[model samples]
Target: MHLLRPLPQYLVSRYHGWVATSYAENSAWYRRLADDGQRPRAMVISCCDSRVHVTSIFGADSGEFFIHRNIANLVPPYAPDGLQHGTSAAVEYAVTALKVAHLIVVGHTSCGGVAGCHAMCSGQAPELEEKSSFVGRWMDILRPGYERVKDLPADQQVAALEREAVLVSIENLMGFPFVKAAVEGEQLSLHGLVHDIRAGTLEQAEDGGRRWTRV
Candidate 1:
């Protein structure tokens, strides 16, 4: 915990200082955004990983993209059982309230969730039911991807699963009524992208293609 102190203190202090200066630098734009309300053109669903930053990668400003981050950047199927659904609620707000024109599902290489899924697939991790852990349950979202690429070499397996997981998340995003309607009406577009954290490169999945090409 002592070693982690630098991050928290820097974020609360140095980062806040930077934010304050940025707000002043773009005062007019910030004021307009506040007055007219946020009208971001895109909504980014991405991992909570510190390395996978949507704004930096897309060169977006404060009001440019409404963002949602979660473990593995998943978008689960819509459920109405009154469960505490953070990601789902964010999706609803971004689509219905913000009315963003595009929704980008961003996946990254060497993700822990993807690694965990690979562990589970290889019998290296505990079973979901046996674990009784929130992370284990959440990681179930990647099970299909894990199963799909289980036979590949370890390095390739991670890449394949990560890509497949992005596709699954896109499908899940379409499960929401607001998203489906917006997309079908051509009011919104969906994009799937993978960020290779190690190489500092981004790849966008081609329309109607399973493989992603470097952007």
Candidate 2:
């Protein structure tokens, strides 16, 4: 078998510099976090896209937010059928174990996952429809979200579906029994936000989805 190479030496050197500077400067805080463990007040589920910047946008420090990132930032319906569900496991841990006070689902514009779902559902990306296609199967969670925006013009559907993805995730998050109970008991709050990647703006779903006001 052919082995892959490690990160370039320049990247490794940069990491070492960061450790000697940033790590050394904040070593006390890092040590305290290790000793006390994490007690984050909110759990943020965002997209795997590198530009989402949940921490930078919120000015959050390490250990302040429990973050879980997945393609297109989706939450599948609650299913305890003994399948390997990574996203579900994260939600279970954050909600049941960590007892986070808030759960936020953040979707962003120009999401490749959302675009692929549009293509697959719209017959533009047939490869994703294959039974062995893991991405298509994982993106099935957003199929309903696609349906919500499929009626728009071809050029406009992707962005609309992006917003729907957030709505769908927020809806699916409630499907978990414990999450529902926690919300009803006033122990947890749910939020849906969409990031405008190019404009550097955020819009929030409000008035029970009647409108999305800029945040």
Among all candidates shown, the one with the greatest lDDT: 2
Give per-candidate clash totals: 0, 0
lDDT of 1 at 13: 91
Report the lDDT tens digits of candidate 2 across residue range 1-215: 87998999999999999999989999999999999999999999999999999999999988989999999999999999999999999999999999999999999999999999999999999999999999999899999988878888978999889988889898998999999999999999999999999999999999766589999
> Looking at model 1, which ten-residue stretch has the lowest summed lDDT?
1-10
For candidate 1, report its TM-score: 0.88
Name the lDDT of candidate 2.
0.93
- Which candidate's TM-score is highest? 2
Window of ten residues with lowest summed lDDT in model 2: 204-213
Checking candidate 2 for backbone clashes, the offending pairs are none
The C-alpha stretches of model 1 lying farther than 4 A from their native spots are 1-12, 127-131, 207-209
